[model samples]
Target chain A: MMKYYYDLMSQPSRACYIFLKKNKIPFTPCPLRITKGEHRSEEYTKINPFQLVPAIEHNGFNLTESVAILRYLCREFPHVGEEWYPSDSKIQARIDEYMEWQHLNTRMQLAMYFQTKFIIPKMTGTEPDMKTVERSQDRMETILDQFEEIWLDNRPYVAGDKITVADIVAICELEQPSMAGYDVTEGRPKLAEYMKRVKKHLQPEYDEAFEQVYRVRGRFWGGENAPHSKL
Target chain B: MMKYYYDLMSQPSRACYIFLKKNKIPFTPCPLRITKGEHRSEEYTKINPFQLVPAIEHNGFNLTESVAILRYLCREFPHVGEEWYPSDSKIQARIDEYMEWQHLNTRMQLAMYFQTKFIIPKMTGTEPDMKTVERSQDRMETILDQFEEIWLDNRPYVAGDKITVADIVAICELEQPSMAGYDVTEGRPKLAEYMKRVKKHLQPEYDEAFEQVYRVRGRFWGGENAPHSKL
Candidate 1:
């Protein structure tokens, strides 16, 4: 049996978790709470030197990085719908383009917004810096515009008409800041439609993965070390 | 012929340029000079919404992001040998791991070092702030340590004994700072040896792609813009 290590609070980990479950890949879910610093424990570090989430241990082959794990799973379990990772060379390239671009565009940009607006200040019980929050929000808005105009652009999905890992990964990052009470897809019809399509397509797994993250938004609203929101 | 849009000064651009050339993939080199602000042109903007280098247009399919382009080229031209991408699923996953991890770890970190230590100061005609430079350099060094100790761990190549696209992308980013007369490989025997191995494997194409980036080191040594030193 494969051992999957993750914390849903992590945007990338959600992608991996959703991917594995959606594909019906049997694996043990080993939740490592990032807020508890469990990810940095010596044991976890032995699994992933970077001490980040979305790592898997299968038959002694350990791997980290959500995109890598996703791609590996696609190959390791081809019985799953090919739309998630497509078999055609051209379509795979398109999916690869999105996966690669989102690292900086969708993922990192939103993480900046979430960390500045919520994570750092809440975790430490300090007042969130308005200036930092405003700056990140501004950056997020610009990137979201790019996401809407360039990426969505009336396309049914990020890759094409079907929901793929690219859409799953994109939705995970886009929704990460919702843990801070911010929705980047707000007011963007194309993105919102895309989100709706993704949400409906992913169904209960989508809600289940994001439920804890959204619950976290309430836990730290007024700061002052709140009980760890059961993720 | 495929169309390649690039600027040698752009780190990611170098990766795509080298991969395409090394594999003998036919592409019309369309160099976009970042120093001259050519990449921000409206025409180029239509091609890449992010307006970044290392984009490709092939059979009406346009793609940005060097990793995507490299993977696409590998798939579109499988005759280039499986070692660059690998026919084995596990090996491909390892390469994907490196490519994904490198975005935040290797690429962004090195770009920060080069930008703060060189580009920002030179472009603005302002004195390079030692504090900022030191901070970025510190970050760069830490990630390099990660790359060496955790990543390499004395492996002959990034993904294993054979060379892969991961090596190509990593080498481009590692060499990016040499334009500032700085070598991250310096004082690190393992990284230095890894660079030697990559360079030897890549051969003349490696030197050819990095030519202009290496030449830029000579143009602004004393904080003044010198004539473009021929690469």
Candidate 2:
């Protein structure tokens, strides 16, 4: 059996969790409390020097990086269906394009949202810079616009009609801003509708896993930490 | 035949070039001069709105992002051999860990080198800030040290004894500092040896492609009438 080391609130961890559960892959969960700084402990650092979560240990081989783990899983369980990771050259390329592009665009943009919402408030003991937060929201909006126009177009999901890992990756990052109290769905109707479609496509097992994680977060924070609600 | 749009000086483009050549994959080379802002042109942006180079068009599929393209090629041409992309799950996961880790750690550090050695010099119209350059170099050294301690250890390459795309990705970024006139090989015998080994593995093709693009760069000026390097 494989062991998954992750924190539920982590965007990438959720993506990985959703991937594993959706694929019906079984693994022992080793949840870390990132907010409490458990990831920085010497014990955890030995597992991953980078100190980030969503790592895995299988048959004595330790691996980190959600994207890499996802790719590895795709190889291991090829029958999870082609939609998660399309075998078609063009579709794979599109997913790849998103994966690479999102590092700077989506990843960085979401960081701004996180910094403004959680990090700044927690660190400074003051309200976040609303101007910066607004700017980040605008930047996210621009990226989303591009996602809709270039990637989504008329398709029900990103990278064509099927729900690929690209959608999982994208939705997770988008969820960051939503968690930060911004209603990403309000202004972007197509994106909101697409999110609904993606949720519908998620397997019941995966959905249940996500719900379990969400309940834990909600109880911890005393608010609507549900996937769809603002964090 | 596939067509590759790239600027060899770019780190990611070099990764793609090295992989394509190493694997003996043939494609029409369409070079973009990043110094002249060719990548941002309307024509080029049509191909990749992100305005990054190393975009590829194969069998009517247009793809950008070096990592994605690398994976696609590995899959499409399985005969390229297992060393480049191992088939085993555990070994492959190790490779994934390095690939994902490099994006922020190694890649970001190397980009700082680029900023200090190239961008800053071009901007200030004088020698770059040596203090900043040294700091950036130190950052890169830290990453390289970790690369050896955590990832490389006693192994000949990143994944294992055999080199994979992870090595190619790692080395390409490391090469940027060297190309900009820093002797990265000094004081790090293991890294120096590894560089030699990587070069030796792909030298024939690497040198040939490098020479072709290296000479073309001499004709370039920063802007319409900006000063060019005399050498």
Q: Give interface RMSD for all predictions.
A: 0.8, 1.7
The 0-to-1 C-alpha lDDT of every candidate, in the order given, reads: 0.83, 0.76
Model 2, span B1-231: residue lDDT tens: 999999877888888988888777989989999889999999888788778888988887778888888888888788874768877877877877787778777788878887897677976899878898889888988887877677667889988889889888987777666545555666677877787787778778667656633453434333333221221
Q: Tell me the TM-score for chain B of model 1.
A: 0.92
Clashes of 1: 0
User: What DockQ would you assign to candidate 1?
Assistant: 0.84
Residue-by-residue lDDT tens digits, candidate 2, A1-231: 999999867778888888888777999989998878999999888788878898888777777888888887887778874758877877877777787677767776776777786677877899878888788778877877777667767788777777899888887777666545555676667888887777777756445546644554355344544445532
Off by over 4 Å in 1: A219-231, B219-231
Per-residue lDDT of model 1, residues A114-170, tens digit only: 889877997798989999999999988888998899888768988877788898899
Candidate 1 vs. true structure, TM-score: 0.93
Query: Least accurate stretch of 10 residues (summed lDDT) in model 1 chain B?
Result: B222-231
**Which run of 10 residues does model 1 chain A get worst, by summed lDDT?**
A222-231
Off by over 4 Å in 2: A81-83, A129-141, A203-231, B124-139, B179-181, B212-231
Clashing pairs in 1: none
